[model samples]
Target: MAGLAGTGLSGAGAVGMALPAPPAGPPAQVGGLRVCERGDTTYLLDRSGRVRSLTYARLVPDNRLWVRQSYDRAGRLTGLSVSWSGFAGRLLDVRGSFDARGRLVRESGFRARGVTTPLGSYLRAVPRGLTC
Candidate 1:
């Protein structure tokens, strides 16, 4: 499927069938992370209005992800991960997390979907991730 390939994930069937795309309306309100579209980029903004990460919402029909960026509290890009949503076996993951000093310390989950992240990822992270 076009949506599956959009994630940069090889082997569409490898990950599993992609779920039909969620209706693209306004970007979903995800806790302390506010989403906004600037050109083709979808950015996840921290409460202070700094860019915490940038994500792509390409292929609206069955949205997928390219590369995901995560920032430290100091506004440094700390980690990267591939998140996918809508697949029959879609994964919710953090990929990695770093300390305020920007050092990778602990890791939680990973599925390797490479598509847009499912809500589980945010639900799991933002509760503790968002500070200030």
Candidate 2:
């Protein structure tokens, strides 16, 4: 359990794939990263090929809006938002904004009331300007 709702101060997620390699296809542009699709799921990758974001199908089959991400033209992350789909369509998490120099300005996060482990969750995921 990590933050669900702050400034981009948490989310120290490592750049790695959560699933197997996507099926072959020309890389699609996702914000400042390259995106590839595997069936209904899409993966965002940085210039170095690190994972950045993921968008997979929801109950609506082709509903790619279940997750969203944005970045500056130079590849700095600007926004990221998520929500469940259909009847359960509720916002799950968000992060946002970058300074003129492309630094993360602020993020949206939750308090994480019962989270114990400082791993995986935002508690352990320090943002760019802050020390954990």
Candidate 3:
């Protein structure tokens, strides 16, 4: 039987089996720095080569942003936060949970002060269909 990775869930479900490989040339440039891109998605890598943030333009023309947190040697996320721009600006204070394999199993968010009040506990489930 095909495992989750074989079934196209590898790398946090960012890659699908039928999807073409990322471009083979040098990474894309943003702000005079090289960035990794998959199709139109772009990722910002820190000096240590870890992903620091992501920026993508949605199909509807709205831009999405994600900020990643640092982790300690023990593999726990030392901090977590996220923000999106649309309808003004919305910020989320995020916390992540990981399984034994270090894969993120869940995440919780709270609306930061000065942002619009989020309905329901400010928590939303990560949809399986989402990439990145």
Cα deviation at 117, candidate 1, in Å, is 23
Residue-wise C-alpha lDDT for candidate 2, range 22-46, written one tens digit per residue: 7976667766777665565566666
Q: By TM-score, how accurate is candidate 2?
A: 0.33
Q: Per-residue lDDT for 1-132 in model 1, tens only?
A: 666566766664657666898896855567778777666666777767677776654445555545576776567757756555554545544566556765567656666546354432431122234322
Candidate 1 vs. true structure, TM-score: 0.38
Model 2, 103: alpha-carbon shift in Å? 22
29-117: candidate 3 lDDT, tens digit per residue = 55544576566545555444555444444333454545444344443344434555554555554556555554666767766577654
Better of 1 and 3 by TM-score: 1
Which one wins on TM-score?
Answer: 1
Among all candidates shown, the one with the greatest lDDT: 1
Each candidate's clash count? 4, 9, 0
- Candidate 1 — which pairs collide? 19-86, 83-115, 84-115, 85-116
